[model samples]
Target: MFYPLKFDHKYIEKVWGGRKFENYREDMPEGKIGESWDISAHESEMSVAVNGKLAGKTLKELAEMYPQQILGKDIEIEEFPLLLKFIDAQAQLSIQVHPDDKYAEKYQGESGKNEAWYVIDADEDAYLIIGTEDCTESEFKKAVQNDQINQYVHKVKVEKGDVFFIKAGLLHAIGAGIMLAEVQQSSDTTYRVYDYGRDRGLQLSKALEVIDFQLQSGKRKGLKVCGEDYDYSYYCLNNKFALDIINIKTEYEASGEEDRFYILTAVEGQGKIIWDEQELELSETESVLIPAYCEEYKIKGNLKLMKSYVPDLEKSKSQILSVVE
Candidate 1:
């Protein structure tokens, strides 16, 4: 009934190759020398419980082993809604854009993408490629053809604790020397317009098909934010998915309705989360799922968090659900 879900994050090549966190397994010599990456690159958010019932399986395996628990249970987690990741971009990634849900279903028969970033670390000139300035689709296509889009792409310097909400069709990329946690719709549908010619064997034709000329996410005028009590700042950004950034210090509590569950990822700081009959101390890099039933919950300790949830995937209830296929 109580088991930890595990997934494997397969490493692919990157412009700024990521460091292997597993290499520094508790190897500190009394001096906090370097960064310790605890977040794993996982494929599945293993499902161990279904509507408080013991399902005892991973989302991937369970989809097959116990499809009933997943597709037709008291609480249906049809498929993992989002892909959560912690990225330490040592180099600039490819400048790309993704389709929204409507476009996805119509063209690719897939779900669209809506992603947000919680800046963790940055350098003196770290920035983000938000969108281009006064550029039309024809101009963008011309640039893409000439392999000069990077020069035309806009950039904005970033800092820790800063948040960037990337909606579908937004032309964007994460620059080097920055690390952050990203919570996004569970779709890997990125059409890279420019990769800086990093990958030896790269493809471009497929990317052109998905790139939308009419859609452009310009520089952020302002991200939705509010005062948490009198000291900290919190923000809300939503599209296909909903994500709330709550800056916690000393004492802070979060309130939400019983619409759906929540994945509370501790992107920063040390804190204790109090839920229905349980209190947990979360380290720097840890995430826990709060059941939808626990309507009222609170968080204590000094922390900054990125919590993700599907705003309206609630009533997909089936009379019989399987834990895995």
Candidate 2:
């Protein structure tokens, strides 16, 4: 019998990282903590169960043991379908691009990356680079050679509660003084175009090969305010996954159908998730994995959460549209 399962954080340090992770966990190492992988099963890093009988087990092991229960009956995902992380960018990240699935499989033996970012907070002047202006291959190459890349790069100012959907092959970068939640395919194949004088070998050749020159610049619009009363919003709903933000007032009930499992992250406030005779005290920045086919559950309290899961696009689309209309 599966209940709500929480996972321990896997902290990673980086040159552009800051100390924002201290708000989520107290045992972080003394260094610039860049990201905390909240729920992951990627080969590079994995999360461990933090509660109940499955405590200490890696997410990979749990999925393998209870495939249909944890990942859904129809989810034939090779490993985990999604990777969730909290990123604290004290400084700018490298301007980079990720190949599509076909390109990645042929060259890197991995899946491609299509990610979404939900800005949790941002400094007064924080911004991001999404893509370049319309330019021919020769024009882009010349800009790179002349160290005038910024001239073609598209920059957009960001603020709290903003969201962006970064498709594969788009040249983009997360700017400094921003903290956000990232959801993406479980791949880490990055081809950097620029690193702002970091001296790290740039993947210029590979990045140029995969870059989508026609992709428009700027970030995606904010989450769609689908439902009335501002109780629900649809952040993203695509072939790979669906994400929704729920604003709980007094109590909210969530169903667990057999086709998909839900990963819920409490982004603000405090609450208790109760199901199957088990209850977990959910705090800010904590996450829980509710297995597929598990009993229905109730979230009680005033809080905000991001819910993600594999989705049947056709059926999910109609369902969402009806609610919004």
Candidate 3:
């Protein structure tokens, strides 16, 4: 009864959004479309299936009805664990921070936000605000009060194919002229620290509480494992989720773990996922959910895809370590 599921996009209009998605998508509504939520189960915005027998059913509904088959035996049915999106930034985003799990649960009553970005495209001068320069809590407060926070925030140039992991408590912002795929914990709590004079409230107190001054930003170039027809790499892996990239020259084969579901997002070219005589076409910037019960599948065509899923930490570590050894 289970098959790979595709969901309708949830487009969010933002002041800093752009028309970049027009390059790959035809259904984008006319506006500054900043984010297309590809797969989500957050109470605020859940994804609805748009394919096969599951058409019109929300992600939460499917999880509730078939938790073991949809989310697998390792995940709890209380809420879906991950949020996936493609973001286009026409202007710089507000500098912000997110609370860790313990703090988020006590204050916002939600999961903490830990996110990763895989750059799909970037302009010649595109950049990102990662963390803060070495500064004490008192100095940071002073900078905010004096309208000089920019002097304390660290900036780094970005390019296509770059990867960054933004853990909770790390201040960050996406600069203009960039498009990327983001995989994050399912939460919407952001403590905005600076907004470049936008008419928005600043959550200085909370941001100060969660901002970790010691955190530094860097791109993740994962260890590569070459296959006969493809190359696979693990970008980021934590208790929250694991992010990987697969580049297929001809075709690649994989199987779904009985304990966890997998999300495959196409970042370049096009491909078809074939399994048990069924096939689904995937294009750039689109995502599909491979149900936990899916035994095996073959991705055919020349393409690059980003994969994300909840992980068994110890098992994942061993797999990576085995490669190094």
Candidate 4:
């Protein structure tokens, strides 16, 4: 009964949110709808199915009910491994850091957070604060206490299609007038170092504890086009997950080889996801979940989207690189 599952939107109000997502869906929360948890199974926020017999069922319940089929084989985690969302930063977000898995489990009793951002839209003046200048531990500590951290923070102008890989323990912030797609660990354990005069809690000590002072510019590997035939790029390929931007002109074939589930979001244009004689229309900003047990599927149409899934790093290297060449 499970084809590709589309879930109802879970919009979150934030101080820095804007009305940008209104273009995609109506009935957004009254206040600043900063985030839309498109596909999540975190206890903090759960996405529920909107179609099929699974309608009204929470993603967490589905994961539990159909573990292997929903999450994939050998994935025995209690909660979903990844959380995907759209972030609309009207004003600047608080400068923050997140712990690694070890630190998070020991202190917060949750998994750590490692995230990436794909700039969906940016205004002419849009930029972000990423990483910081090299500083001594004592100097950095003083800067945080005195609210002079901006002098040490690294800034970068953003453009559409930009990708930034935010590893755990990195001090970063989403600046004003930027909308982005975030792929990250399910955990939301953020340690706030600075809030730019906001009334939010500051975890200077915890943030400093996990902050990587030696971090330079947060520039990650650039996403490169694969080949002439396929207009796709491998944006991120880490142990946790692999993210690829695929532009389907005619048709695209995908096989669930790793026995892992997949999350595909149409970021641009529309298409029909055809699998086993079934078809579902996918439009911009719409996300669909492909079950782990599903066989080969074809995405047909002139569509541009992102494909995300947990990957076997060693096994996928050759296949992933071959597409680039």
Candidate 5:
């Protein structure tokens, strides 16, 4: 079937992820809100354009309409496998963790959450809480009880165009005023640790039950920059199920092959992707999926893109040539 793309909106009741990212504006005259973003928004599950289009349609629509043009040759129809999102942190998000494949199999067999963050925009002092700093179970529990979590987790200053890979079971959160895009395994299971003394009627007992005690026993130093920092490239914090990032003024083209489907997400920029007969234009914080069976795909029009496909650089030359040709 042919490619179907649409723009869907996600309105979360949570106060942190508001609707600033969805309507972002630039400094130039026409640059006014060319890209989609959120200032205080949560649950970046919406804005899914390519695969599950038409604002909550059936899976059959995806299968019959955009089959060869959505997922790849190696994947199955039942395994959508990935969930893409755009998140804006107007305020600090909850310090939380997730369950990996093994843990999820044992505890939540149907749920596995592994996600990565691509920094779309950040303040001069925007910082991120990734993993733990140094806290034993007792100390962590006490900190949680007293609501003093700032001393427990590792924090790092961040900037636009930087990418951090967040694996399942990693304790992390986005600080205030940071906009990001996330790609993950299609599960939304999250365990919140602390929430800055806010009363949402949610208890922390559930989080304590799932928190990993082993990691807290060890110390984790945040990604450090001792001196001046410039536009640093993507440093994969973790690649649990996929690769994620934030790019700038660039383009990526994945020539169709027998391996995997090409997932293209635009964190920032104005660009067009050429896939088979489909010519898709992408703006900031938008995402699209290009199926593998499709013909030679080309990407033009300068933009920052984050791309993920199953890593198969080890394929034989004959097989590689057979597909791209």
Candidate 6:
């Protein structure tokens, strides 16, 4: 049966991780937990269902067995299109870049990554490394070799609710003291350019091939639309995916789209999703998959949710514009 599905958090430990997630969830394992793969179907890490009759099934299995029900009728892709996660950067990350679709398919046999970060919380001094200062390929190469790359990178101060779109080929790094939720195309291919002298290999050759020095990177001030009971913030809309922030004052009613499924993640506060006489609790840092076949649903609570899905560009644009008009 198609119902809202919740998954077990897959915590990944990293050298730069910390116990920051402990503030929001109690299931955090003891260690430097860097990331929680909340909703994913990638080969690197697939999310497992933890609620309803679908309990214990991996996302990949469901996608393969019930593609139409799980991914929607218009989503022709056999694989689940997006990967959602929470990142806690207690320490700085390496400077890196991901390949575009054409390059990735020909070379790495995978989809390109186009990701966006939604800051949930951050220290007063938290920041992020977006693109780099103006420089030629050779000059940027030299800086990396000489450990002078930091001098050429642009750092932006971040605060809660800040959003950044990291398109493929844009160089970036997550600075320390920040915790955020990330939504991206389902791919794990990354080329690290600089690792702060850590004992890790550098992918300079591949990084140079994919880095787009001219690409502009900065905060995304989403278009806001007010609703009777809530506020909607549309952050990104592209062929890859669409992202929106729904701020529920008391409750919100919605229905599944015919073309694609929706992944609703509660980034702040708590709520319950009701549909077909069934309901699921959604608390901070929790995600629920609302399958395309779901006819209707309602979210009730004082909360903020990050909604992501594969999009039909024209249809999505029209839906948002309709409200503005």
Clashes of each: 23, 0, 0, 0, 14, 0
TM-score, one value per model: 0.71, 0.94, 0.98, 0.93, 0.73, 0.97
The alpha-carbon deviation from the true structure for residue 216 of candidate 6, after best TM-score superposition, in angstroms, is 1.0
TM for candidate 1 is: 0.71
Model 2 per-residue lDDT tens digits across residues 41-131 = 9888899998888899999999998888888887987477888989999999999999989999999998899888878889999999998
> How would you encode candidate 1's per-residue C-alpha lDDT over 1-325 as one tens digit per residue?
2222223333344446456333322322332122222222224233333323334444455444543422223335556556666676777777888888887778767678888777877888999988676676677778878987866777888987777778776778888877777777776667767777666443456555655545555333333334554133324345355566666767766544344555677777878866566566665556665544444567788877677766543322121122112
The residue pairs found clashing in candidate 3 are none
C-alpha RMSD values across all candidates: 8.3, 2.0, 1.0, 2.0, 7.6, 1.2
Deviating ranges (above 4 Å) for candidate 5: 2-7, 22-69, 201-206, 213-240, 244-253, 275-278, 312-325
Instruction: Summarize candidate 3's per-residue lDDT along 1-325 as a digit string, tens digits.
Output: 7878999999999999999999998899999999999899998778999988889999999888888898988887556799999999999999999999999999999999999999999999999999999899899899988999988999989999999999999999999999999999999999999899999899999999999999997899798999989999999999999999999999988877779899999999999998878888988998999888876889999999999999999999999999999
lDDT of 2 at 284: 69
In model 4, what are the clashing residue pairs, if there are any? none
lDDT of 6: 0.91
**Evaluation by TM-score, superior candidate among 4 and 6:** 6
What does candidate 5's lDDT look like per residue over 43-62, in tens digits? 34333333333434533345
Q: lDDT: which is higher, 2 or 3?
A: 3
lDDT of 3 at 2: 80
**Model 5 score (lDDT):** 0.58
The TM-score measured for candidate 6 stands at 0.97
lDDT of 6 by residue, 191-224 (tens): 9999998888889999999999999778998999
Candidate lDDT scores, in order, read 0.59, 0.84, 0.92, 0.84, 0.58, 0.91
